[model samples]
Target: MSKRCLSSAMLKFAIAIMTLILLISFSFISSGAYAQEKISILIPEDPTFHDLDSYLDIPVVMVNNTDINVGGFDFLIQYDTGAVELLDVNLGPVDHCNWALIGHRPEIPGVEKIYAASGPNPLGCDFSYSTDTLFYLQFHIKPDTANECLTFPLRFYWVQCADGHVINTVGDSVYISDSVYDPYIGDFIQQDDTFPTIHGLPDSCANIPGGNKIKLVDFYNGVINVACIDEIDDIGDINLNGIPYEIADYVLFQSYYIYGPDIFNIDLQMQLGATDCNKDSTYPTVRDLIFMYRVIIGDISPYPKLGDDGNELIQPTALFVQDTLAQEVHLVFPDSLSAIHLIFEGEIVPDYSGPEGIAYNYDGIVTRLLLNPGFSGTDSAVYQGLFFTYTGDGIIDSADVSDWEMRDIASEVGVIGELICGDANSDGLVNISDAVYIANYVFIGGNPPFPLESGNVNCDGAVNISDAVWIINYVFIGGNDPCDADGDGIPDC
Candidate 1:
């Protein structure tokens, strides 16, 4: 308990307390440094030229100064209503932020509100980015603006971090100048204290031969203007109607040529343009009339032969064949066509029981099927597989295949002929023998029938006991004749 001992103990305690305080201070500084991240809204400093009545795209960019992930943001953009008119607000590509909501208040004419958030809700956005465009403001310069410069100021109303912490952010401003180039005068002038004016086409374009009826081609930078004369070349359509050349149109063309424009109540000049079937780029003549007659008789098509709406006419040429082994009638097309609709007139099988419902494949130079719904793939030229079903009686014959029609992609109807169905055995007749063959194949795994349609006695697609019973009923009980209902030389299935 001496004085020297008391002094030494007090000094040691003081030193120990100071060491602990310094360690705590160091820990606090380290934690603060790790949390020091910021977010901001950046506006470009460059001034854009404001062209009257022209669109100006102003980009609002978001800057994440920290490496921390951002969850969501709410922004407010204020513009000068008198200087520019807001047309549209579009969202930009903010990675991982898939949901966005935008609102414009017309009552507060110049203000736009935007709220965007990232996905996988609850956990919110799981992405980190340095900079990205938040949205675009499409504005049109007002025709009556007097200000030389328009300013758009951005304000971050609310910003949230991935951890659900509200963040404070800084925003910037964008400037657009009203001083623009006057194309007529070829000079830049400041728009001040006066309404803006839009430049019109040059005086030379005003005196074009076709007046305002000419089409403007290659129009760029408001300088080069080429006027093209519009001409209609619908061969055989002498009446100027929006249909294919027909007999009525032929008569009109002939009468107009023999007599004069006064011979008909229709516009003779327009009729001449339509009747120029040869497309020789000249007026209609006797040769054009002859061409129209040929088109009617299917000898030839009108020059530049096209159906309505400039689409090429589809004359579907189908080859109907019987798959003896499968016992299915396939209607094959030479070219690829889509949206095909076909009608079979006689008895034929409709459904197939195989794994391949109807066993169809696009086998040609391009053979790719698009599995996606609503997807029109590049291979649209060759399409196949149209199965026939019994319409009248279950009896399929040659007439069924011969008396069928198909509509091509262009909706043009075409007739098919010389094709036969219901000859699965290829024996030329559908009867009890055909039914027995089908049953043997289905039950005992006998030889498959050729031109498969013949084996489908019941026209139910598969050769089975049901088809055998159908044949027995038809042969003995007079139920129905197989492939001979109408008795026309062809099967109508």
Candidate 2:
């Protein structure tokens, strides 16, 4: 063979091998790119129960379906602002890379824009990716949009790889709709078959002995579930105040007896339920009033039976221990309760304007002090005085306190106790003087606070600088109220 022919043959063989190698590499790269190059907005299934003015959180997800490391991407999300207001955006785990909010624009009357980008430290750099949430968009459903389906559309401008390659990315929209019971999985199931069997029959189910029968025969193959109805019953809740029987309950019962149910602007059925203090399966009778009075005077326990739903009623207890030296009374609950309503019956009057004094709204007969905002698991609070010094000798006991009531989230009532807090100077008020007194007792050679526990404003067990600082902050800068570790409403030592 000639030299030229041999060289040409050798060149052709080398070219063929190189081409095969390139084809193999290209196939692997293509498959990896396809696998990792998609982004989506994930909307969770509608909650079992949804109401107007509720907030919903929707997530933006990136499905890194390729072998290439992700450097960055730009995203534009659009949603109906009228149906739901975009309250906030929260970063997700995938937001380790630097992210910037480009701009947010109201595109139309109902629609709005959220534009954001995530990339390398500077820009156009690569970061590895798997499946991860990129961010969350928090939205508040508008009242008018209740029962309506809302859609969130996502658009990805570009997804760049670590090697500076722009990959084609797929994006999806999320749909949020009101919760609805579906009779069938799809459009094909017949309504007759989908209807649940009521007592083994359909139309005549209500006439059956139990009204509806639920059977759990297949223990191995089936699941049995019980769900409590969300309705809260404040039965024996006199005054219809969403609490159990109290002094107000007696007054409300009397008003109902004298003037009839129409005298109060309350639901008659709810009132009847609440006013049934005796819970003898009857409503608005002289017997119920007498039972309520007895309960209020501590003659009989309120609601000594289980609720109509067969659940044990939550009964909270409240008590107060007086700090005689500080002249402050601290409200305490034996168990967790949300709110408390106290009535000073005799000559007892709580000083309502001092530092430790809690301001309250008065309804002539009773002075109301709301311990915490709404219903709280918090069971303690401190008030300045149990009785006004001028009105009486300032000595208060359970007798001077006409009524003490506590309530839980379900409006279940319990008993309450009283005590004192934050009055370090042993004065009748918690004020700048108390902070000064704590500071002097801690820093200088001064007499220690009357109740040493009150000097520990932070309730850290020691009268120290932090306690003085805490007291100063409470008196001047409006810091948190003194700590009550035991929930006894007293600043603990």
Candidate 3:
């Protein structure tokens, strides 16, 4: 256009540049000819915690720990369409490649996958990469109403894009690749408006080998495991039973104590069970356990506490020094005894009686049989009781309900029999009863998974009907034992 003819030196310079490009390409042809064993395209293994309908960003790493050297690269990424939507792809921070050719090969027949490639930048080895991030992918989690945790994978594929441009083997979009430098224009431009196969497909899709390549050991796919734990608003209603007091609620209480905040991280229903079981402005304590036991045994109620006259409200367990006695009570009770102090409540007419010395009384309540008549500060027998019932804000007396309620039968954290994980009943066995317990608890708000961690028979970390079915399969059907392999709870054998 400038009316000037090309100078000889300029022509020579252009030829030299082209010659150098060919030489560099051929040099890589040898360096990358043999696939190395250490080459691997890795996705993040740790779970990607993403919000529903929200975007999640993850890294695509390539750990090339071998002598293989390559100047270009390409691969296809596949994912579950229903669970996530791939939004965008970006080059990693390292000197991976100067430019990348990315497109969706939607023409493919089956699951969707993305075809991405990089290189040919006259710039020096942009990808002799060893342990580096290759690409960062952003994904949007599709909205679904799963009440429990679920895992979805993001893996690499060996798709042969077919038409020389990888359209059929790639994912869902129009293809773009071939590029070349124009001599007269003196700059690189799109010579063929199509994605080039210069970079071969993922090693597994090896029909067409590119000029530069790397041998990948395996497809280290990653996942985004989403947890859909619902938050319960009611106090002590851990299992979502209408009332806050039940065997199921107690089971969750044990889990909350053992796993701590992590359990809450999985289920927000424990929020009420944790933040304030008694509304005392404090998180759950043994006091809450005692309270839960009272409600379970029909001794107290979390509902509007109205007296018989329907006017005055009386909290049943006012006698025990409220709170601050979980461990102390566990330490009491040297051993099992017969005549235990049956401490219920004095607010109900100050006195009441039940079968076999099971009664609720107050105001000079303890006799010598109960606490040596005048003994205080703890009797020699540790609250000096045996086989007593504190099933109530209705039961516990001023004689320290801790010794009874906090016994190993299920202290603040555990139950009587928690040998393995599938024991939903905790009655020292895993059988139809445990399955029935989980089913009733999961479907009808009956009782929770006993031992808190026991009901996860399937080991997916949440107790549900699937676990009940697994128990059925193991019980009468002779399946794997209940112990999980992780050893976080007990031995697997």
Candidate 4:
């Protein structure tokens, strides 16, 4: 045996030992892999558009497998902070074990840990499962992710009795049985007397009895999608009066907030991409109302609220609410635009004007004119624009987030200026008294409007009771304005 020959032999011996070790290790490694095949973890298939900051639930299901008992189980979920905010979690209906436990403290930014055992001392009791959800996660989409399609990964970061698993062993060979077992020899598997029957683990049968020991589990990952709507609309238009982020919307939103949508027939769906004035939720809140108030009072700022998010929202150049009951119409500006113009077919009264109180004229199949081209503030003056209403059905109904989109009232009108479009009695203001006077003139043959056009509030080419009723609703119930003769978005008589 020369030194070179001895070295070669030693190398060969080392290789032989390493190969033997690997072969032995493969047996134990392959033992628990069957769990992944027998078990499954599934997330929700909720394709419905979940509004940002709206709450939702994600279920973790285990399906398509024969019944199996779990003696102990442990796992953790990973999520994205930008996409959702984890609120709470609930154990599956079948997850009731002797000592089922779960904790969701943000120990890690996006991680939630959970664990359960049949018995504390030995982690027994075996929770059986076939096809059922294992757990549920409660979350709300973050408002900041509005108008964005985001995908967050849902995966189990850790699973006990499977990952980093161990079995009754001597040194190398694993005693993979539930009963006190027998093993190969020294350093690997001798004779063991401990029980490793973790019902939470998958079935196994390697030198162990009953094949009820813990085994490795194969894991699958999934994703949840947060998407924008088919098309973006107005933000403040809770009632969808075609005016985004304006006084009419604010009024509707305020009403809805105070009385709820059901009472006012307000459609929240109309607020899809709109609403959320404070940018905290897709739904309206007190904070949003406060923000809108500030904007109206000219105290608006992005601080403490929302920055410019490029979401599509149509701001109504002018909102015309129709009062069919009072046979009246009222014009409003959701925003401030100078040199505004309004055109009508029936007629417009200069009994009420604004800022400079100037009226202009136009020529067409329908007369085009300036309803209020130079109004500084609408608080009192703008609210009174075309103050008319209609009581055709006896109920006061306002537009919602779905009714109509903001249509540009600016057109090639023959003339334009703010010159009191209503006031059938030529009063400085338009109110219920005007409705009464016009009603007297039409039905009772009493004193009629001085110009008659003042009495034609709806501009329907008539001074009938319908116009009086509309005006009454407008004054008493805040009816909509600028009645569209054909339901077209544009305001006209």
Candidate 5:
């Protein structure tokens, strides 16, 4: 055989080997995929879907058909105007869609409202009867893509209530079971305060004996904190006085069912309203209350806290909290603007006074308004222009990275600039207060603020004799000082 022929034969043999290897790899990949569990979408059993008017007061059921038991579930009910309401998710009585029930009367707690700052009064400021006719019902649940992989074939259902009221439902239960997936159930930190009252409904499953029945579970979606309310009437005897306190506003709450997994990190917002009962004021404005919660099913495993984000568990004696999580709007105007009433907007949680709907403000002027967290695009244009006016420099700077965090840390460190604790000698800062605080720690059985002293006057991390000398120089020796951390009060040094 010639050298060229031999070389050609070798090349063909090598090609044959490579082809065999490729075929083997492809077979393994396909087999592995096929072996994975499949998921499917589930929906309410028929008849209920055909007509919801017959089952207004009844519960909706969702069926899950994943191969592995799912811990819990969640879904969203988007309104025609693009408003999305989250349904109860802890898989029980119904899937996660029964959380939209508006009661004919108030029975829950903390959701009732009498007078809103807005213009038109819907239920009359009398706080009379609570009804469910004001709203249209709908919802949808998407998979938590981060925590779990959704495989094909995952299914769930929604059983409508039997109250005679009809709600428009849309969207299909998307199946996601075949692939390896996890649920993105968020985190929950043990808080000092009780969970905020969440207004909603309970899951309604069939009365099956054993084969996977829906469990009526209780869930905290969020809070509807009514920061303030105002009422007004013109040229007439106001019979109800200020606000009447509706039953629906006070009693509406959220309920759910849990079975396979736990639901956590729920949130809610209280809608504020300014309706002119007399219809004498300008067009009404809307407002909102921010709320949130977390669910823990049968058992709670270890989870991360907000501060302990990275590997370390930064245990804190006390955690800081804000009035709202999402951004909000604050209004500030000259004398003429004080009378313009402001309102908060959002969906009403279920409560007793009424269907815990939004609160509308009746009448009033606008003074200084501060929207917690921040504001959104829909907020009043006037409010968006008002910035937090900071008196004196260094106290706050928009460009500072941790300026807000530093203020909070200072408060936690006992230098809150309030009582004697912050005002050492009551003079305020580095002056006599600084000297007094240092003396007391050194000789008067007092403990110096440890980590906090790092931000203390004179740039010394520890309260020592040198700090005392510097305090004296700044207070009496005509030395320039930079210790006015906050320029509100007189410098103690």
Candidate 6:
């Protein structure tokens, strides 16, 4: 009786142990899966239910619009909390000739002026959810030559990128022209290595009356004038300098907005010839105005948020500064500037701001800082800000600390060896290899005026023995780095 009872009890214990082990294994697997997933939120700044200061409402993520293109539209994510984000934006084909913004100036090559379309009325364009899973918007041209009949089928699409929709094109070839007038269409223009140029014209020729009120236009009549110092030769006029060259001024005209579609007429009226030998006469001249426009893709809402901590972190406005002017200095954040500092170096100047001081003396406006070339031996200018150079993790609670701190800036990047010497070839840094450059200019170089001898640098002005000395001082002894024509300290060579 004892042997049977012992065997049964042993079997029961084994079964119970196995059941406990299975439960523990399942719990471990579930926990590991959760850890592998990333932490992603739709909005970095939760707008849950709060009193917004402005009319612009924060958008909620419609998870359905994840990857699907609504109609023929492209989407992008403007901002993402982490998990939800825009995938990509399709700008358009590569071949179209792009144009810049009208009246708006591009601070850099590829970037155009972004208009801050703010007011009390409803914005010209508003975004909304389309399908349950797709956030979509179609921008239609009001009507113009390409879409004058409103039948050009010119459309730009905004599709969900990550948490937001990116402005893009669905299909190709909706409109064709040297430069399209529709902002929506232009938004999809491909960004190329080469940037578009503004129609170079005098300001007088910019204000002509024609075309869509929003489109850019050119003004001025076409009658090029010339000066005649001597008798009017067959070629027409000669200046007092005795040089017979065309003496004419050029102008550019453009319109701001082209709402729908209308005739954008090009009137080229040329005036007869006139002469002012002494250079004191003013006559009507043929002027041309070229207008440029750039499409800015973003939420164009400008309503303010009352007691909004988010608003305080961002600058009231946006700017497209060039790298040349953006390289210098540490970006200032709202924290105190006395604690930490960022070190930056490059052909560009350093921009710095914080508790130490503001970059510009004009106003407390902490725009890009231009380092004093008078202090450094670089060619590029400095750009400073009272914010982080780029988006990143910060030490302070950026939302609460509104004033820029002095020590918190960090130089995240630096352009090394940007100094240029008498190399004459304009390459940064000087070495024995530059000797060939010297020989070419001295012996074979031909010109109306030989390369200025004083520029030889070595002081003999002969471009030979003297030039070498100038190079040595600039590179080693720190001679007045002549290249710094701007005196911001960077050698402007």
Q: Which digits, one per residue and each the tens of the lDDT, describe model 5 over residues 239-335? A: 2223322222211111111110011112221111212211113211111111111101112111111111111111111111111211211221111
Candidate 4 TM-score, true structure as reference: 0.30
Residue-level lDDT of model 4, residues 1-493, one tens digit each, is 6999878756655554454344333432232122322444444333222456666556655432323554444556677776777887777444444444433455467877654444334433332334445566777777775536656665554323332122211113222222211111112121222223112223323335433343333334446666563344455566677766676765555445323444346455666336566443444433455555555556654222111211111222234433333455554433333332333543333334354453423232332333221124443224425633322222122222210111222211111112233465544467755666565556434445544566676778888877766665555444445243344555575
Give lDDT for model 5.
Answer: 0.23
- Global lDDT of each candidate: 0.40, 0.40, 0.44, 0.44, 0.23, 0.24
Tens digits of per-residue lDDT for model 3 on 261-373? 34555457455444344333345554455556556666665421111211111111211221112211112222332222323333222221323232333334332113211
Order candidates by TM-score, high to low. 3, 4, 2, 1, 5, 6
Query: How far off is residue 95 in model 1, in Å?
Result: 8.1
Say which candidate scores most in TM-score.
Answer: 3
Each prediction's TM-score against the native? 0.24, 0.24, 0.31, 0.30, 0.16, 0.15
**How far off is residue 409 in model 6, in Å?**
12
Residue 480 of model 6: what lDDT?
Answer: 51
Better of 3 and 5 by TM-score: 3
Candidate 1 residue lDDT tens string, 35-139: 113444433332243233445555555444355454555444455665666787766444344444333343234555565544444332443435456566666
The C-alpha stretches of model 4 lying farther than 4 A from their native spots are 1-37, 45-49, 92-96, 100-107, 120-129, 158-218, 230-493
Worst 10 residues of 4 by lDDT: 179-188
lDDT of 2 by residue, 146-171 (tens): 33433332212111111001222111
- Candidate 2 matches the true fold with a TM-score of 0.24
Candidate 1 vs candidate 3, TM-score winner: 3
Identify the runs in model 1 with alpha carbons over 4 angstroms from their true place.
Answer: 1-36, 100-107, 119-129, 149-493
lDDT of 3: 0.44
Query: Which lDDT tens digits does candidate 6 get at residues 302-358?
Result: 111211223121122111111222232222222322112122221222333422332
